[model samples]
Target: MFQHLLVPTDGSALSDAAVRTAVTLATAFKARITGLHVMPELHVFTHRIDTLEDTQERYAQLAERHAEQYLAAVARAAQEAAVVCEVISVTHDQPDEAIIRAS
Candidate 1:
């Protein structure tokens, strides 16, 4: 029996589905769930690159906002399902590393 579950979400439709499924499973199994969102690490070189429209600064801002939004959704799903959930986010260029650390 699973006592704890870790659910990582990106706020995409597919990711959302997975989060919901995790919540349902937690509710049924009477387990705890942790939601994680990893924002890409902002590299110094990334700022040097210029976009046709927005600058790297803008992109970084958007990424931060998106991370917050995605993590919020995870919390909402867990709450609606009446499942205990813990949420956290970190900046790591390699999302895999972040996930590993989170777990």
Candidate 2:
């Protein structure tokens, strides 16, 4: 009888199993699902003088793209399962912490 479900993914093949499982459960329960992709906090180590391989803007853009790609598959799975789904991406230092926050 779940009314809402939160699914976290990093776009790996392993995580796809979780997404499919969540989608199936959500569909069975007629629930809405929220898929989350947590990006790493890019600024933490970017300030190091030795790490200036690219600009902050470039790094942010690349991160955003990767996050979107990861979340997109979940959205598509939810769609196929006919479950209402919302996706969000955020940056946090620790993924476990971000998953807890999203939950």
* Leading candidate by lDDT: 2
**Candidate number with greatest TM-score:** 2
**Candidate 1 C-alpha lDDT tens digits along 24-84:** 8999999999989888865554534455236557777888799889988988988988888
Cα-based TM-score, every candidate: 0.80, 0.87
lDDT of each: 0.84, 0.89
